[model samples]
Target: MTTQENVRRVLDWAVAEIGVPGIVAEVKDGDQTWFASAGVADIRTGAARRPGEYLHTGSSGKAFTAAVLLSLEAEGRLSLEDTVNTRLPGVLGTNGYDGDKITIRHLLSNTGGLFPTGLAPEVSHRYATRSGILEHRFDTFTTEELLRIAVSQPPVGAPGDRFEYANGGFHLAGAIIEKITGNTYAEEVDRRVIQPLGLTHTRVRPLDDTGYPAPHPRAYSTLFLKDGADPSTVTPENWESLMEEPGQPPLDVTEFNTSLAWSAGNVVSTTGDMIHFVDSMVTGSLLPPAQHRQLWTTVSTEGSYWMPHARYGLGMFEFDKQATGGRTLRGVGGSLWGTWFLAVGTPDDQHTIAVHTNTEWKSWDLMFKLIEAEFGVAIGA
Candidate 1:
């Protein structure tokens, strides 16, 4: 079968067997491009998933946050070496973290020992359960509120101690942007990157915007959290077992306020825009020489709570030749209620793949298969 056919098969398999509500993906290979989707956008109406629809880019926006800050550094407006103490004054010291020791770069790279909100039961309760999301879907959180939750917990470790996914660290980044430029992170991103690159479908989701633009698929989540449930234990494999009732339909969670996500997520985009935008990121087409080098400067994720096989850059990650498929694909990924997105490509921009399912989370087998199909990457190669 053709590679496109194989990719389509995987998408179909994801929907039919893996229980994703819908899926859309696009592959950009130099002058040629391919797009396809499977399953239903609106399960009730059987509407089709399409390529141009807006997608929730969860933590994928973290990359853009880093890019904008790096742009500032390029202009000598700020330095990545600046400490949290240096930038924000008194934010990190209270939570057993020493702001004096933590650099802005540590926040971007998630090595700052910041508290991971997902590890909090309260946070997991609200975002990972049907009942909780239904009740709190319209909730709005200020930047301060997010930061408060972040530091409420003790530090995960000392600064630069190891890799741990810290969502709130990027919110601190947004604060730094505001402190330096007198502009919100979103505004800086729009003024500097999105408009300049002509990324038509990319928009920074504001805190108050609870709905997606037109052509968005209804996102669903199979979150059936039982009482006293440890949210950390809930994975795709053990999902059904945790449900109140077996074989329940995934809950629709398309509309959600993104205020809490802010700099970490809060970006809505299309697959085309994602690959285009990420292409600029990995290729360093938009950064100066020094900042670009800093952008890709690597950190080991071996001790990370997420993506341990990957090596993290400022806001991106790379699976080097020693990683699973022995080919380097550097990019960012994000997961939220009802959506999981991955926009990655070869370091040289030879092939870019953006894929997502309008369902909570999965094994990402389909994403990897799509990449291999598009690039003709043999297993273990």
Candidate 2:
């Protein structure tokens, strides 16, 4: 099939098999570009997903956070080797691990040895104030809050012992940015990254309810009761309508308050903007060549089978080789609420493929297939 036909085929299969309510995809290689969308944005209002719609980039936000930190380092405001305690004292308290032993590098590499808190609580003391909550729009967070959460929990292992993915580290990084710049995390992000990139559609808005712009898709999730009750049997129409309620309780639906997971997962963007950000990073427009290289260096494995060479570097996931068929692609994946995103590309090829969906069920597989078909190479499961 021709490339256009191939793209269409992939879109059809995605909607049919994955129950993807909406998708915004962008494929680019050198001078070539292809954009497409399928299904309705709001199944309730019969609103179709349109080109240029924005979706929450999720953990993909980490790449931007890392870039901001690297930029600060370039300015000589801080160094990655600085210990957490030096910048934010009494924050990590002495109860759990030695906060002084955990360096900024540990946090960035996910080797800080901080234990997991499962998923963060949807509401917290950190965002108790209206101003604090709104600050999430620009990535506001405090180092003290983040370190307390990290050190209060028992160690997953000794520092640098092994890779244990933790959002606490990134949250700490966000706080460090605030301390060094004397600016809120959001302001620093805008000055250092978003505004520089001319990314108009992207913002850190966590409490805003303006919804996505025109042609936007309303996000949905499959709700299952925590009490072991049967999953909600609501139809798609009802699901679409229910999303209109703001400040809805977490128990009511699959949507999550990502503000609680700031720095690590609190980013929102579009496929187009994401591709632009990656292109800039790989081409050395964002960071110095050396710093960019540092960002790609891997620290730990994501899992054994799926990601053999998968390592967390800075705020990004680096896949050295695919666990499936080894068609090389490197980028990031993020999940929030019921949404999922995958952005993959190779340095030598300049070919980037990004996919964002409004639902989480089997979303990763759907993104992998689209990448494989577009790049003409098979990827593992």
Candidate 3:
């Protein structure tokens, strides 16, 4: 069988065994590109997943935010060592923590130890449940509000000491970008990365965009609230109901506001655009020497999520070769309301695989299998 056929076989198996409604996967190996999709993008219309549909990639956008910051550093607008106090004084660490202790480097590396922010767990859990996202799909929030929710809590670890994924750090990074350039994160990303890269379909969701742009698939998930429970009656004690029901039909969650994540997880793009971004990023062609070093210098994440011994450098992740049979892959991966994505390639940008699914609820091993199929290296040995 052809290599493309074999890849399709793997995707089909994943759809059947993993039980996601639909998926779009693209692979770039040298000059050859293979694209495949299965199931339906919109169950209501039975629309097949397309190759060009956009998806809301969650934390994966962190890499893009980091790249934009590196670009700013290349321009001498800021330094990685600049502390939170330097950029936005009196705005961080209101919960008995010190903003002076955190640096831009620490935030990019996710070692800032800024509290995870109340919205982090709350949104994560809410999205995980079937209809939880529907509760406030149209609600809008400011970046300042999200940051306040985060700093309202104490630090998770000392600055630069340990790895703790804090979305607030990226939000603060966005704030710092605004402070330095006098532009919003969305505006900066457009000027630096999106427009220059010719990513026409890619965009940073504006604070008021409660719905996704057209030519996209509809996303679905289980309700976060209990069966027949009123959305208005939700309470912290029953918030655990946000867990997805294994055998229930998914509710449509395609339309929802993304400002809750702001610079941290609010970028939307297609599989092809993501692969292009990853290629430019890993090859060191995206930034200058000093800023490039900041992009690659990594610290251990100690097996966060599905990646074993993963190291985060800036906004990207470096999956260790030792854990993957001596073949290292670098990029980022995460899920959102109606999307789950993983993009990783060799450091030289010669080979790459990018996949997007319309559903976030699935077995973690499903992603690992997709990686192994595309890159010929199994994760976790």
Candidate 4:
């Protein structure tokens, strides 16, 4: 197939393999741009997905959170070395963890060693307010209550020992932002990044599925009524109605209510906005030169036995450099409520690609492969 045809086929395969209602992808290199969409936004209604439709970026939101925090540091409002207790007192104490011992750097780099609370479900239920979601609750507990839950749980490892990838660390980062800025985390994010970048389509508010914006794809999930049922028997379907299903609860699928993952991962955005933000960061426009260097420095590796070539930066991932066919792509991947997003690119060239889908399938890998072949460069793994 021709290069253009190869790109089209990769996108087509992604939509088909994931069983997504639709996908909107954007790619840019130098002065060139390419946009493509496949499948329906709402299969039942035959609606098509559009380029500007916002999707839940899941953990991919971490990059934005990290950027905001770095920007705050650059402004001399705070320091990465500041201990958590120095900013928010008596919060981490309930969890038996010393906030004073955990620095902002530790949180940003996922080296804090906090355990993941099974609180995503609980946070999803109690918090409807944007602030409330950033301050996720456990059994209706406030931010303080959730911190207590985290403290009560044993540490995954010693602070700053190694990377454990805890969402709680980011949540703490969000709380720190709130404590320092005296504003909602959403407000800080918007003022610092969203507004500055003019990302009109991106938002930190809860998604409204019923009255979803035009040309947006409906999310989907795989559900099984019986335990241990054949996984293959399950099928993907439009999850737009799932948000409103009575006796079914929306939090069941995503429990990111607390901003515990706030600085780690809680922002919602569009593919275009993500690519734009990434472009700005790599180009040293959003962050100071020194801090931006710290952001790209590898702090950990993400893959385990099942996936081998994934590495972790502050909040981003470094997939197989060789597999990407040699383009030094740096970005993040997030999954929430069966929705998935991947934003990636290189620094030297202006090349960047973002893929968003409603179903949480492995089809996103194809996006990197297509870009690799298109650019003919190896992204650092």
Candidate 3 residue 72 Cα shift, in angstroms, is: 1.4
Give model 3's TM-score versus the native structure.
Answer: 0.91
lDDT of 1 by residue, 183-291 (tens): 8778999988899888999989987898898989998877567666667676435755765554677787777786778898889999999988888887878788788
Q: Which residue runs does candidate 4 get wrong by more than 4 Å? A: 94-96, 118-142, 145-152, 206-212, 223-263, 302-308, 320-327, 361-364, 367-381
TM-score of 2: 0.81
Error of 2 at 178 (Å): 0.1
lDDT of 3 by residue, 90-125 (tens): 887477767888999998888987755533544544
Query: In model 4, how large is the Cα lDDT of residue 373?
Result: 54
Clashes of 2: 3
Give the number of the best model, judged by TM-score.
1
Each prediction's Cα RMSD?
2.5, 7.0, 3.3, 7.0
Put down candidate 2 lDDT per residue, 178-223, tens digits, no spaces: 8888988888888989999999888775533334555556776642
Q: Which whole-number lDDT from 0 to 100 does residue 112 have in model 3?
A: 88
After superposition, the stretches of candidate 2 with alpha carbons farther than 4 Å from their true spots are 120-147, 206-210, 223-226, 229-257, 302-309, 322-328, 361-363
What lDDT does each candidate get?
0.82, 0.67, 0.78, 0.64
